[model samples]
Target: MEDPRTDGAGSARREPEAAAWGERVARFVRGRVFPRESVLDGGGPEAAEALAALRAEARAEGLWALPLPAALGGGGLSFGAYAELAEAEGASDHGPAALGSAPLLDVTMLARFGRPEVREAYLKRLVAGEVRTCYAMTEPGVPGTDPFRTATRAERHPDGGWLVTGRKWFTSGAAGADLVTVMARTSGAAGDREGLSLLLVPTGSAGFRVVRELPVLGAPGQYEIALDGVRVPADHLLGEPGEALAIAGERLQLGRTLRCLRWLGQAQRAFDLMCERAATHDGSRGPLADQQLVQAHVFDALLALRTTRPLVREAVALIASGRDARTEVGLAKVAAARMLQQVADSAIQIHGAAGLGPDTPLPALFRTGRAARILDGPDELHITAVARRVLRTYGRAG
Candidate 1:
């Protein structure tokens, strides 16, 4: 477990300091997070208490917010170094939040584009984990694949502010968020790409409401929300007007890459479970590991994990250097997601009835595996996008 250091050329190398930090994270995930999955996932006062205790422990152990800036009260790890530990940190669903890395994307976005007022109001608290935030970009009826078609609108008010109105669903962590970064049309029509903008909206606003929880595969977190003419102060806008798509694209590049790493971690966890079961669980003939079919499952899962890791790492290197990583990120996103799903399925199959039951983590892994394809951007979208980008190069040569 080494922290991956990047050279001047943005290539990954090994570093002892980073390795020690990465090991601390892996140990924390295994020692603390893994043991409390039931309580953390339970969703009640007890779950809240458990999570708070974990966060406090994480802070006490000096393992909190490793990827955020040192000026912002974090460990100040570069994205390159953090990418090495992300897989370990993200092995459990609660890892990022507990370790205070969950807010990296939003915190970074706000630090870069937030108005003085917005930053002064929330940035410190967000990094300190005093408050939580969620991003709202997906609309209820609009296809999330096309941001140009966003239906949410933010109209200019007489006072030079905004009146936002929209319905958004599948907004993760909205139920507990203190603030939300919403994507809305500021000028152009629904199909126009130029008018989308980012607005910072507090959940306590006059017209803000959480409609309901939209659980995925019986797991909680996602929510539907409504904004009925919510008044947002003029300075609440992120970056310039009509810059939401650009901001979101930058956010997603990192977001999707981190997600791919986490998916690989979870897939590796599932693969381990599958192997352990195969080696120990007796079958009709003998040990399941001896069976060719079970061996094939092991081989395939390992191969997927092995191949997807390098693609994800390559994307990480490109992003860490502030290069255009759209193609690399797109390829890694699809590959890692599919790898997770395939590996998790094989794990579940090896486990038989117990895998589907609540006794094992296999069920939860499988649930996330299924949803991974659709989240961020669906597999089909990534496939077409990557193919289009690749084809354009050949087109230019011709």
Candidate 2:
């Protein structure tokens, strides 16, 4: 398919295709994912089976991994085009996993930097959903904000393979992953920026072990892992030695943008729930929608959602075009996270006790909202990073 930005006419043509796909994904999420959300979120053999069934159905309907590269057995939608569908696909937390888009970051990274053998080994299986992967970067007792201080190290064995040693916590999806991409220092001291590299380790490797599950806001996915001299072949190294930071930076640019899109979807759902309750639920005073305070919640939530969407879209466009997008992504990440929390809080308030209970999805939505701020490098990090980048331009001008 032609890149829409390559020509004037292609831009108009791609819009309808993306819109149509977005609608299909949205419908699937509503019909398939929403109904099974409780089971999917519960995390067990039953949840795994339900999720696998959903994946099968998604694949049968031709809705699996639309955003992934076509060569990798996906629909091969461009990032910009996929941005249109991401919101719908991410409405429920399980949407990405069910629809086969969850491994996007790992797939792309391995494809770009993996040795021919590494790609041959895992890329196709990964795209085909035959396996699962997780990323381990943050460590327990260490501030994830400062990755340069990572204490994990990978030493070269006599055979020239790598033996990795360290611990990582909050590694999402680690419990079931077939492979894990680890960040470890190959040559630098703990505080040095250079010499860090990424290595692909099979979960079944002798020394690799999952220490424990680390629940986030009561959700079951994150894990603490220990890599005690886990060995990997020389070719499993991603990019050049000391290139981990560069590669991770590129990955995060896209990851944060995708997250912003998902947060917007969640926020929109919360807003809808808030509106529905206000309109239909009649309290002692009258319909909640008739109350002035309830109206305030609706107005504020709508304003936030509207204002944050454009920021996220701008970031998506920039990243899709392969330009530097740090400033835009940071702004969108903070805004979308805050918007989700604010909107979901209002939705829960409108639902009263029912929102906090298992009867409604408000609590789950709110939990995500609360966690969004901390995950992917908290709001303060983005706020300061964007500010620093902006101020640098002024410094250059002066």
Candidate 3:
């Protein structure tokens, strides 16, 4: 049977040419990136040189920017098709960046809300991998994941610009991003959701600074940044003033769904490694796969993977159909995050001491699995939100 994950598009849907494209992506990453991740992660000149070569290879294969719109020079794959491709691309940590598809979210957002000049300046370069960007919404004093408590402020300048002042943290990719989209309070009082606005700040601006590259759960690249009286041109404002939430909502809906797809891929990769170990490794009594205890672990891991796959697909299907999938996404987010963590634990236990070492991918996968629940809104927040949203159906006030 065709794997339902790739085939779930139904008979009426387009042929999942992605099954072939995805295989190509997987092969490229496994051959080019999977073996060189350590050098890339080391942040050395050799890593940069290797990455440039790998990216060039991806571009040569016409694999660059597969996630954006074809009109924007992307492959124009549907969310479903991209989901298949993303799963394969995600098996390696550097796959998206190496393949020139890392800017999908930023490009999509800029295309929707940027002014003509802003679009002209950054859109094409972003699709072509000439630049990179990050979104900064989390602030130090605010309640994490609660944008209503945002303290960053952007005051309009008299000469067609704005003065942005604030400190932000957990801004992913900020260390290397050329432009940063910052969510700040531009109108209304603190805690007023409607007053928030997003502004584009060039990293080289006068008062913009990257304070430090945050070491999140032993992972780098996340950063803390400060913007003190940073002046940005008026045209850089995204969407309308006092309406950042709506634009942010659109980005998050798709962003969260894509993260779920990638998480599924990472989990599947770990599961494969775990099974490979079980089948081949010698144990106290023989092959680990021959042991009943190890059999239980394999059964449980497969069960979790199969169960979460459909819930995530349901959310992806709803979002692809342009429907509000808050509940579906929330459920999938929690399930996929926990599933990855659980499966990683099982994989580690099966690998014994080898799991925690650098020789295996389990340690890295485990770290990401642990961070997943917290990064895209913590599991607690999603659980409460999903419960509240679901309870509202029976006329119950959550």
Candidate 4:
């Protein structure tokens, strides 16, 4: 097979095959697995047998971990290609989450800075779906947009380990996570970006505890974690102290790009649902599709999907091409979130009261829709970053 990483842009490559495989994977999940999404409706263990069977099948069919490094037992798709595949997976809630295929910031840390043993221990398990991990950076009372304001403290331990103490909320998937990639201040560094480090803490470790699951407006569950003297060996530290911000910033850009792709899938799904509802509903004299208001909403949803998809695709391509697209990714993140919100809202409006009820899928989609504005750093933060980049790149009359 041709190496996707080495192929030149716009050159004839194996992307078609990769996209075909992604479609197959998406179809398999949609046909066989989505019906079981009800398992995750309430706080409950996913249908273990079905889930395990799907994982095994995915692994056998070379569709396991698309985002991890290929040498580490993952599909060797590039970021651009992976973004396309991610859109398909993101169309349904269970697909991306269950596959453990979303963009993982900690994976970048482990790949770039971890020791060989650390990679073998953590990355392998994560890629194989044997464990789930969460990145804990945001504190409960602190504004998550400003990392310099974090209050979590990690003190050196006498036994060659570290003691981590803090409270974290809005942690995605932390409830069932096997480990947490925690960010804490280790030194008395003057700047927020300094004196910080990333540590790996096991879930049931000495002082690691989950306080409660937070209920999002539309999603199933998130978790609040309290680390009261959680201890881990010194080897748990990822990268050197005071390098957390740089590492996290780089990782966050990649995360935002991935999120844009996922939300594209979500927006497309909503658009499709809206169209289907419009075509079939007969509350008006004509089909909803025949109504000018309904047509206008559908047109707006299509435009949003079209506009955001290319921006996200371009951002992913730029990042994959070894360019730093912190600004572009930020702008794309904001646009994608807004577009998805608009699409979801239109879907609900087209469906009328039925959309709000449990019988239709729009309510569930609305829950996911509402979080687009906040997840992976909110719109305000990204907008600020975009402005800063704009000023630095094109300052007044320089």
User: Using Cα atoms with residue i matched to residue i, what is each candidate's TM-score against the true structure?
Assistant: 0.95, 0.96, 0.94, 0.92
- List the candidates ranked by lDDT, beginning with the highest: 2, 1, 3, 4
TM-score of candidate 4 against the unseen true structure: 0.92
What are the Cα lDDT values of the candidates?
A: 0.89, 0.90, 0.85, 0.77
In candidate 3, what are the lDDT values of residues 1-398, reduced to their tens digit?
11121223232233457688888898998889888889887775887788899999998997877666665666666666778788778877788889987787788788778888998999888888888899999988777778988889999899989999999999988877899999999988788767999999999899999998888778777899999999999999999898788988888877888888888888998999999999999897999999999999899999999999999999988877777899999999999999999899999999999998999889988888899999778999999999988878878468
| Top candidate when judged by lDDT against the true structure | 2
Which scores better on TM-score, 2 or 3? 2
State the lDDT of candidate 2 residue by residue for 1-398, as single tens digits. Answer: 23312122334434459889999999999999999999988889999899999999999999987776666677677778888999999999999999999888888788788899998999879889998999999998889899989999999999999999999999999999999999999996999978899999999999999999988989889999999999999999999889999989988888898899999989999999999999999989998989999999999999999999999999988887778899999999999999999999999999999998999899999999999999899899999999999998887443
**1 against 3, candidate with superior lDDT:** 1
lDDT of 1 by residue, 247-326 (tens): 89999998999899899889989999999999889999999989999999999999999999999999999987778999
| lDDT of predicted model 2 | 0.90
For model 2 the local lDDT of residue 378 reads 87
> Whose TM-score is higher: candidate 1's or candidate 3's?
1
Question: Model 4, clash count?
Answer: 1
For TM-score, candidate 2 versus 4, the one ahead is 2
* Candidates by TM-score, descending order: 2, 1, 3, 4
* Candidate 2 to truth, TM: 0.96
